[model samples]
Target: MLDAALKQQLQTYLERVVQPIEIVASLDDSAKAREMQELLQEIAPLTSKITLTERRDDNERKPSFAITRPGTDISVRFAGIPLGHEFTSLVLALLQVGGHPIKLDAPVIEQIRNLDGAFEFEVFMSLSCHNCPEVVQALNTMSIINPRIKITSIDGGVFKDEAEARQVLAVPMLFMNGEYFSQGRASVEEILAKLDTAGGARKAEELSTKEPFDVLIVGGGPAGAAAAIYAARKGIRTGVVSDRFGGQVLDTLAIENFVSMKETEGPRFAIALEEHVKHYEVDIMNTQRGAKLVPGKLIEVHTESGAVLKSKSVILATGARWREINVPGEKEYRNHGVAYCPHCDGPLFKGKRVAVVGGGNSGVEAAIDLAGIVKHVTLIEYAGELRADAILQKKLYSLPNVKVITSAQTTEVHGDGKIVNGLSYKDRSSGDTHKLELEGVFVQIGLVPNTEWLKGAVDLSRYGEIEVDVRGQTSVPGVFAAGDVTTVPFKQIVIAVGEGAKASLSAFDYLVRSSVEEKELAPTTAAA
Candidate 1:
């Protein structure tokens, strides 16, 4: 239960008076509902709160509240304790409820209004892909502006069948009324134009005027982008397909030691890297997901938008995703206070208390880095001792703000409204239970390669990593794998980039050799 003082503070915070805010609490207890009611009443004369019991019949959906206030036309729904990006969504919803239009300029608005009839659009996304958020936000905004657009956004791995059915080979795909539209970041104007063309009553296939690409690389991370840069530099027709423009690099919090650069954050570093890649002849489809891989003498990539890309060679650079603990609230708190990447989400919790789960090198490093930024860092280890190197362990323990708790396992995360407040854990040493108060939790358990879809098509390690030779060649002759997903000892950004470049070169060589072999075989038959 919240104390009266805290309730008064929340009430005052609610009364800023310009916009209305509503919090939909999904709780089972009636006593908690009463507490919320009392809290709302104290928020001055402006705010109006509606309970979930009053609106819905069932409890499985949890009780949510709609908040409205005087002089505001917008109604915001605070769904199940908003945190992380959800917190940002909550604020926007409140602003919207207060009649604040998240204005898209005339051109964007015009295109949206002109979209005809009902359309179902599905976009595949990856959290690790930096560009996924932008695509999601754009589509979400479009949905809010136009009701005709029904957007179904699914996680790529989670919705494998849907992806395979549509032949999705990458992330952030935009599927138009049952047909593939376009991949990558289509501007508001471009989408409108494409939609208009597809929705026209007459059904005639219009040949695209865009020049054909020499090499169409799938995935973005370090591998794909590096391939794009190298291929473009080599004067090969190169284009990149990715749901997120930045790939795995964006999730890194701080990269103090990526070769060539002194220090950089993951997102900023990726932005710069992306810009450099685009400086060449590379055309990047940053928002499109790969829908299918068409096999032949030459590889053809069919995207979600039905844009068939015929390439002499294709490079598979789709990276890995973070593995979850399966603990309660793990999914709910993702991208909120609970995070998978220390590089991307660490700064958000600066000067605040936080926890780091896992005792591996990644976890130890993350805790040490976070200790420098946050007020304190609590290291939770499920094992009896740290799994990191001795030097790293020493460095981690040396930090004044860092505390290593061995043989501890997180049982559940506890939070209310905004961000993560704390978590409950079990002390393995004593089998004692204890609750901890923390502002954020960084998960560094490990990653699962994004290769499950490539079963039988490629050689994968027992650990699920793509099995690659010294030359980055997979079991398949023409195909190659790189980055963390490959059986590369190191999962560093520089290594991934290097492997990607090597793989691209290998693919190029394979294409050349295959062409030569075909030519040789043809001449003997003709001569005979």
Candidate 2:
């Protein structure tokens, strides 16, 4: 199953293995087991330092792999087949088990090593989820450094019962010590911060309240990071608060229109964004969610951790998220069969028929991408015609396995108790109801901005996006907005970056004018 290019890449990565590593596959007599076995067999021959062993176990709920090395009793376990992006997790685990040094900062390593008590992390993931592997790899690396930590990667598809029991509606759903930790892609530092808070260390929370900033940026996506960099360059104190740095970009698999970069994956591009911000003096507060924004002469930003950040100016970059269709069974069957990100969940529906909702650029693009992965794809759009670009529409129609239906509204998401089996729709032209037998439904209607926290604090559009002028200035003074969360006409990476720069510059200008006014208004001393 390993392609020649991928095989060569893995072989090169595995060359750093200093010691022999053993991959023990615990399998049952199932098709998934056979597939896992074939995958391991193909991988084992590529490198002489790695070995694979299979053990038949009928009691096992799903195929599992235990990786270990000689002289080490530790067994790093993965609870599902590591295909798609999870393949990177498997390779990284092998490298760590083979004694490769953990690539983390000294302070971060210290924090991980200082973690008290045993913590078990069970990350529910799907193979196709582009963001899942990073979290899995970070946990695995932490486990290697701190033996007290145990990490398990659960494939949501194989462990459907477990996922449903936990109400796992999203990929990369992390559970720390049997409690909900976080969802979506999280950085290693962010995970450690969560651990610190869970353990009642109070370090992360304590550090957050230490100082006020000239500019406090909420949301660490492209927009927020750009603003931070621009503000920090002026030698002013700048800070940023984000639940996760990458935001919606983490769910994207491939990005080609980011300007200058021909192509890049979500995770890789996110790292670059974070790295760029780190080069400046910006105070980055990761894994922190903005709870409320209070604008005044000095804006006050409250975080979920109860940290109150005071700043002269504030920039809102809390990017938008995929808008839900809100039909019946949509919420219940989220991870079961209904998914929003085709790049993140496409592999799970391989050889199965699926439906793509919405006729916009995202929907048509998803259809084009899924057509190659799945047996058949039905593109459903509420508009009379697809709103996608001509090039995209042409590419989509070129696929033989895709069927496009316009002027159709998604009425209900139908599914079995455990998984989605099909969906019901209404033909807008004829007013006729129809049902499509599809195992999966990908909703790509559009994005809803993350501006609920800004309610009543700043001017917001009817759709909840922050209303900003051309200069990225919000209605309220000292408050700015950018990215998909703002009133920007276009929601692209390059556009967001430019908006961020404009917001920061405009904020600086405001400060300079305010400072001059304050100085001029001061009481004058009479000469003696």
Candidate 3:
């Protein structure tokens, strides 16, 4: 199941174990079971601290294993061969069970330890889902911290029957105590906030008491991180407040256009960006969203938790999110059968028919990617022709399971009140409506800026993008905007970084001028 190089790496990582661990397998006669057995046998010998045991139980999910400490009730189970995107999850679980230190804040660990009730987290995941590992690692950590928490990560591909029975069309669908908890990407902070009712009030009180910052950045995308670094470099009191540090970049799958690096994944890049910012003196406030901006001598950025954070200068880098079709049944069936990211949710639709909406590169790329995993793919473009690059279009057309329909407008998503069964569309040329029966619909129209909160506070373009000068300054003084939220032409990561740096420099220049003017006015007032 693992290559020689991978085994070497595993052995090196296993050396960090401080306590003995046990791997208890529950399997039946199957190829995946044999693979799981082989993997367990291979891993146990690398370190004497590890042991493997096997058992068969008809009631339990086959081809599964549990990692536990010898003396405790810690049970972190995997109901499938957790590899691909989940390989790191498997490694983390092993290290955590073996008494390796976990990467979590002390306060969060305490909160988990103090939880009042038991939680059984059954996370349905896919091997190809880029967003699944975070949830798995987080819940596993929580389970480790508090034995009352039990985690079972089930691979959706390996347990298709149960997934379908539960009508789970999305990856990382979390269920706690047999009830639906959440779906899609959920951070540990967000999870705790939901679990603990008073967490928001406490967090708000904590944020409201902080001193004013010289440069406060909103959003934690490429622009926000770059701006924070630049501002902190100037020996100013810099801070970054955001709900999610990675912003829209976390949802991205592939990045081949980023200069200096030929290839990189989104999650890894986001982590590197965060690590780079932490190396500076910037105070980071994660899992906090800037709700309203009140411009004044010291601009006040209000948060959802009713915290009023005052700052000398504010930089808005709140990035954009995936655009929706605004059609009926789209929202009702979201996560049920409607998904925004094909890269994250495509594997769940294996051997099932799905449709991709849009004609641009993202749409065509999604169709191409889905063609390989799904039974068939129908690419519906609203325009007369697909706008993807020539090479991409050629590749998409070459796929046998893919079909393209041009000049078709998506009208309504049809579902059976549980999951999507088909969709309705109209032909632009003939004015004839048609429907495509499928199990999933991937919306790849485009992106909309995350600027709904900025309306009436700052000058917004017709499309709702924050309007800013070349210096990245908005209509309001000391307030700057950048990245996908601004009026910038191109929304590339490189552009966002440059804009953030420019905004920070321009803000510092503004601060210097304001100080000089204030000093000049003081003498005038004295003479008066």
Q: Compose the digit string of candidate 2's lDDT tens values, residues 476-504.
A: 98888889998788788889888888888
lDDT (Cα, tens digit) per residue for candidate 3, span 1-528 = 789999999999999999999999999999989999999998899999999999996567898999999989987999999889989998999999999998888988888788888898899999988888989988988899899999999998898999999988898899999999999787888788888768778888998999999999999999999999999899999999998898888888898989999989988899989999999999898888878999999999999878889999999999999999999999999998999889888988999999999989999999999999999999999999999999999999999999999999999999988999999999999999998999999999988999888889999999999999989999999999889998899789989999999999998888889889999888544455
How do the residues 1-528 of candidate 1 rate in per-residue lDDT, one tens digit apiece?
346775565445444435434443444455534544444444333355322224335552333344444443223333233333333333444444444565666745766866768876765554334444445455555655665665545444434455545555344456777786665444444456566765321211121224555567788888888877877877777878776766766666568888778997676777787878979977776445566665555666655555666666677788887778788877776554777655444544657799999999889998987888789999999999999999999999888999888899899987775457898899988999998998788888888887765776677889888899988887766667778888899788899889989988887777678778888878454555
Stretches > 4 Å off in candidate 1: 1-214, 302-308, 341-353, 368-376, 388-395, 398-401, 414-422, 426-439, 523-528
lDDT of 1 at 417: 50
TM-score of each: 0.58, 0.85, 0.98
How high a TM-score does candidate 3 get? 0.98
lDDT of 2 at 292: 88
Worst 10 residues of 1 by lDDT: 200-209
Q: lDDT-based ranking, best first?
A: 3, 2, 1
Please give the lDDT score at residue 277 for candidate 3.
Answer: 95
CA error at residue 242 for candidate 1, angstroms: 1.0
Error of 2 at 155 (Å): 5.3
Relative to the true structure, how large is the alpha-carbon lDDT of every model? 0.65, 0.85, 0.91
Q: Better model by TM-score, 2 or 3?
A: 3
